[model samples]
Target: MIVGRRWGDAVDSWVKKMQSLVGYRTFTVLTIVITGLLLFLLLINGVRPEKYDIQEFHLSTETIRSIKTVEDPVKTEEERQRAASEVSSVYQFSEEIGENRAAIVTSVIDYVLEEKAESVESLAPMEEQVSDLKENLNVLETDGEGIRFTDGALVSLLLLENESLINLRDSLTASIRDIMSKPIRSEQVANTKNEIERRIRGNLEIPESVLPTAVLIGRYSINENETLNEELTQARIEQARASIEPTRILQGQVIVQEGQIIDREVYRQLKLLGMLTNQSSMKPILGLILFISLCMWLLHMQMTKWRASKEERQRTLLVVMLILIMSVIGMKLISLVSNNFDVSIAFLFPTALAPMLVRSLINERFAVLMAFLTAAIAGIVFQEGYSVVLQMEIALYLLFGGLAGLYVIQGAEKRSHLLQTSLSVAVVNFVFMAFYLLMTQSDYGVSELLFYGIAAITSGLLSGALTIGMLPFFESAFGLISTMKLIELSNPNHPLLKKILTETPGTYHHSVMVANLADAACESIGADGLLARVGCYYHDIGKTKRPGFFIENQMSHANPHDSLPPETSRDIILSHGSDGAKLLQKHKMPKEIIDIAEQHHGTSLLKYFYYKAKEEGQSVNEEDYRYAGPKPQKKETAIISIADSVEAAVRSMKHPTAEKIQEIVHSIIKDRLHDGQFDECDLTLKELKTVERVLCETLNGIFHSRIEYPQ
Candidate 1:
């Protein structure tokens, strides 16, 4: 017998060890997968792509000139060459004519000066006549000769016609003789005047003859020696250098040579190239994909933590994915609409509906994170500047909508709760939108305001609709028990609750008191009061199977303990918790609530029966009478355990008052603390104290002053 017991104990121990090891291994794998997903997302989103290069072209004076003269065709190559040769021939001839004219003018000036210096009196008339002639010569005509007198003249007739002519001629001759007799004062002036006269011989014709010649020369055409392609290439090369090149071939012109500053140009070119490369969509695509993946991983972890059941996990994920898809599609539709209408609809790209729906269906923390990620991705995809504002608005809407849902839908029961939540979300969104518009000083008219209001309402309604539509799928997939379902199960008319009430009235009463105590305690500790209350309602359901065995249903009847042995009685009492768990499972109760019912006793000793047996001199083990239980692992379950014990203990009091109830509550809580009943739960010492106070108040209220029923 000892060997058999030892072998059984060893096997039990090995099984527990293996279970722990498997759990640990599963957790480790999950952690690794989540971490790898996060890392991959970071690598994809966090890193930016290299930019493209652009070539920078500079404009120069030569380029401007080329552009300006591009329309003209007069400066061709052949015309430029011919014009150059003609210009050379004309220049040589002009030089020769200038030299000869200068010499003649110099000799004529010297003769006049000699005549005047030698015979000043005799040459007075001639000097006067010469001055008059010089004055009239200003308007004279010429034909490739010296100035001609307009009036006809004959020298022979002038010598014979009159004595005055002979006198004038002889006097002029004498003056000429006198001038010839005079000594020269300055040879330089004579040489200069002679050089000027020779050069001006034919070319220095009077204005009347030279004006027409000037006009003809102005019309002369010149030939250019370069083709358009050659000119363009030359211009480009010169532009590459910092030189000035002729855009057109002109006579007596040369192209200027200047060195190139490669460094400055190269830097500008590289900068442009870099800009072009940076603008590529590939980098943004990679970054967006990475960001989205990270968001998914974060959401996955958050959902995993929030959901205690597989169905809940699946539901939250589906809802989140649906929200994201809807947001993307809505943005795309808005983009298309805006483009088609030629309006600014980019503001609607980051759909506020996505995060709003997520918050309504899942939770706020995940919604906020998803909102930011969506905004960032929208900005990247749309390539619009207003994506930032859209993102901010989306985040704000998420916050408001999530708070509304959490506030109105907490411990929800009916579908009407969803409607209420939607209304709350709409109100919050409208108020926030109004505040935003006021802050931005927007010039919105009544129509615009109405439009915004409609949009906000639509978004809220959509969120609620999506939540309702998706809730069933999530519930099935994750096997989650929502507050709504819990409330429904807690109804007094529920099949199981009715069975307990009908079969074991005493246990039903005890369950009611337990529910009240648990609700008060859980609420005080900021735990799920509704879950605790409902859990307490069904905690003693197994007593219905054998109603007569429990004391609750033994009203005014003989005690069954008289017939049953202490061990049998203890087993019957202990078996109820296990039986209740089984019943809960059969009824498809959530594991969380089932755990509360199962763990309420938590292996506590059945001291009453055990000590009773001991006093009778019976050999008995205490473990034999102890309740079979798994210890409470959560705040709700721990709260339910304490409430169960305290409610039963307080009910046993002969006379209960406010002060008595307070004392009893404090004592129960203190004992539980000393016994380490709350060690596994997340409840803090302060919360425990709060729970005790609330329980005391609730008990005092329940046992409040009332007139005794008339006998």
Candidate 2:
């Protein structure tokens, strides 16, 4: 035993040393990091494991599935490129060049014919004149290569009788101008040259030599007037690419069928779906770590940055992490089952269970944080090897379901209210799923819709059912006094409450009055009003143990304390505080309530009994006449202490009024403050003033005077 005790002591000492060394914030960070690492490890497997562990040629040992459906980036890119390529390239037309070339050719031909050269002797001068005309036109210079005339074409032009060359020139220039006026792309130059040649030969009765020259000139003059418009072509290609939607595989879609040969195409698909037979990659592991880290950071921010009390920060963080870990474990188990069975009903997991529990036992801000974190984790864990759309839908389901449960349970009272919340959450979930299906335009058979509907509804129902069943355990294990538990304990039907009402009715009424005062005062001071009220209800439960011994329950004016020894009476009164604490502990009440019961009357001297003993010629130790207490440690308990005293004092007044109540309350508060009763609690002077004002107002209302009616 000694060895075991020493070991336990050493372990506790080590824990204390570590806590002191690391400090609260550092300890919180380390805890969150450890939780994130564990969650990352749990979910890294769920994030479609690195390539299936199969050999290239080996028979498939197990059926491989994609965890989440994702877009085939390579295939989508290829398809987009092909679509872009199929778009015709844009071209810019230069009509100015075509018109200038037409003018040059026509002018050259006209100049040659107008010379009227007699024969071959004059042909040289005529050719010189044509060349001069070409130079004057300046169109050929733009082309950089001057047009060449066919053999005998110049002599044929000079020898042409009548207006033959002129007519041919006009015909060729018109055709060339018409063709070049529009966009003549690079690929169309040859066909256009041929068409011009044919038009010159057919439309004009020109000599064959002249026709060849006309064709050559037309082809040369045409040039590539229409150049490719790079900017416009690129814009069109981008537009076409934008029109093509990304091709993605749906979640749970088979990448490679069972027993199918893993050919190149299948292998590519497997690799894209993260099912290829390759070594584990750090990319996914890093991604999971980052995502879990982000969740932990959000949790930390909510805890440290929110309005949580300084003393409860560590405990709140611990509880939230514990709840989140449990939730993630539950989700991971469901994912494993879904993966193994290839079922789509993993959505039926009670994702809302944790959020509702957190909202109930902790704060709503933490619950909201848990809702978002749970959704983000679910998105990663429940990814289908199909498209991202399914993953988003799962996230939506978790978020809406958790939020619905959280909101529906707010202000809930009776046990049946929880069941009503379940139904309400089911309706909300149904609407969410229906909206998703409608927006996505997903085609579903009756059976498929029924399956999803059942899952959605079941998710909400299971969340409610699990939260209802698990709440008490968390409350009991963590010593958490949730509003629901407080309400239940406050019920008159409870055994302890019933015993108080039946055996000590006057004390019960006095407790109720104290509850009213404390509730109002606590609320006014920005403290927990419900907690104060509930604590006040149970603060005097021990008086029921010996009902008649207390003055409040003794209906007959004959005082039981008058007959007993002052020391005995003092012991009986002090024992009530301890007795009330023991009774509360026996009933498994929350510690806050027990503390209020035991500490409302701090370690103050029982002056009435002390003075009675002193007057009776008996020596009384002041320490023995005081109630043993640890003092009120929280704002709510401290407020209850002051409010209880004020209520009993005001009730005993002969003529109660607002001014009288105010003076008495201030005096009582001042006495408590001076006696160091409020020293242990963190309540501020400002809060105390607010409590005094609220109590004064409440007392005024309860004891307000009424006008007499006419007789």
Highest lDDT: which candidate? 2
Candidate 1, 211-309: lDDT as tens digits: 232222111111111123545454454444333222342221212112323244343333322323544456445655565556666766776566343
Clashes of 1: 40
The C-alpha local distance difference test score for the whole of candidate 1 amounts to 0.57
Shift in Å, residue 696, candidate 2 = 2.1
Q: Which 10 successive residues of model 1 have the least lDDT summed?
A: 63-72
Best by TM-score: 2
CA deviation > 4 Å runs, candidate 2: 1-27, 53-261, 265-274, 305-312, 339-343, 387-390, 433-453, 493-495, 498-506, 541-576, 603-628, 674-676, 679-686, 706-711
Tens digit per residue, CA lDDT, model 2, 1-711: 345434434543654565688987687878788888788777876664545765555566556666566788888999899999899988887889788888878776766655554334565565665555444435445436676664366557666765777777777788878888877777887887777767766864666656666676777777678888899999999999999999887666666667866666666777776665564567766777777778887887787686544445766676788888898898888877786653377678876888988998888889988999888888877776544522777888889988988888886875557777888788888898789779978678888888878888898888888888878666665557688888888889988888889999999999999999999988886788899999989999989888988878888768888789998888889899999999987766776788899999987778889999999999778888878987778888888888888988998899898889989999999998998888888888998888888899999999898888999
Q: Locate the minimum summed-lDDT window of 10 residues in model 2.
A: 1-10
Candidate 2: what lDDT? 0.78
Q: What is the lDDT of residue 265 in candidate 2?
A: 63
TM-score of candidate 1 to 2 decimals: 0.55
